[model samples]
Target: MTEDNGGWIVFQRRFDGSTDFYRNWTAYTNGFGDIDAEFYLGNQIIFEITKDENVELRVDLVDKTGESGYAKYSYFSISGPEDFYRLYVNGYSGNAGDSLMYHSGQRFTTFDEDNDLLASNNCAEMYHGAWWYQSCHHSNLNGEYGNDDYGSGPNWYHWRGHYYALNSTRMMIRVRRY
Candidate 1:
């Protein structure tokens, strides 16, 4: 949660490569890892929380060089399992750049579930992580921790290149104020 900013609940956090984000669909649906270290707070829970509210999504990122940036969306939400938990994010405002907008309306994809737009490829299997991939992605937060080999690493492409590994990342959400 934020101390000075709004009450943001951090649902996804990664650092130190303690937890593996390259997981199957079930693992992503139910979520995995400890909240204090690294974790993804289940897609189901996220859908439940954001479905009825005008929520804001914030992604804070720190590169390997210690440079920090953030991406904030005024309206963010996702659909249920029937829809593959399709992403819906808009009203971008932040320093990290609007990388997520490219994925808006895209369905989430895991190694076991090929819901991405690319018909000939499994983005999750190729990228080493699951995400709301639109022909792959512009941001890959849930990826190979601290390893950029084969373009598999936690990265926000608008902030850093695809081959650069990030130092830390956090995805948070809160009810929009106005």
Candidate 2:
């Protein structure tokens, strides 16, 4: 839960294909995986923590070639289950490009729950992971580990294109001191 000597609480992490990110809604909601390894910090807890406070989101990415980049949002939050955990984010500033902004205002989707805007396909099921998807996503860190194929692996589309699977990804958040 600690990184770079900061109090950033990691919400999700992906690296080698050691853990399966392609899980059901309950698993994603209640949380799963080892904290020292790949995991999602659970949507319910995320909503509880950020609902009443100002939080900042940071997404770090390392591409297959070892190049790295990051994207930070000044404000971030999400609505609860009744609204499908709708995403809300703004004020982007970083080197990774604004991939997550495209997913802002979208709803979380899973193989068992299709809440994305895409009418024909369940983005989570098609992409092999769960996520806040809007007509799919520009960033899908929960996808199959190391797959690298289109819609099949963790990706920050703006940083390396959709087909280029990233080497690693970390999504972290912290309460804004101000």
Off by over 4 Å in 1: none
In the range 66-169, model 1's lDDT, one tens digit per residue, is: 88899999999999999998999999999988889999999999999999999899999898999999888898899889788655888888888788878999
| Backbone clashes in model 2, listed as residue pairs | none
Q: How many steric overlaps are in each model, in order?
A: 0, 0
Instruction: Give candidates' CA RMSD values in order.
Output: 1.1, 1.4
Model 1 scores a TM of: 0.97
Clash list (residue pairs), candidate 1: none
lDDT for position 4 in model 2: 44
TM-scores for every predicted model: 0.97, 0.95
Q: Model 1: how far is 160 from its true place, Å?
A: 0.3
Compared with the true structure, what per-residue lDDT tens digits does model 2 show for residues 1-178? 4544477989898888788999998988888999998888899999998899999998889987888899989999999988888999999999988999899999899999999999998999899989999998898889988886896799888888899788899999998766
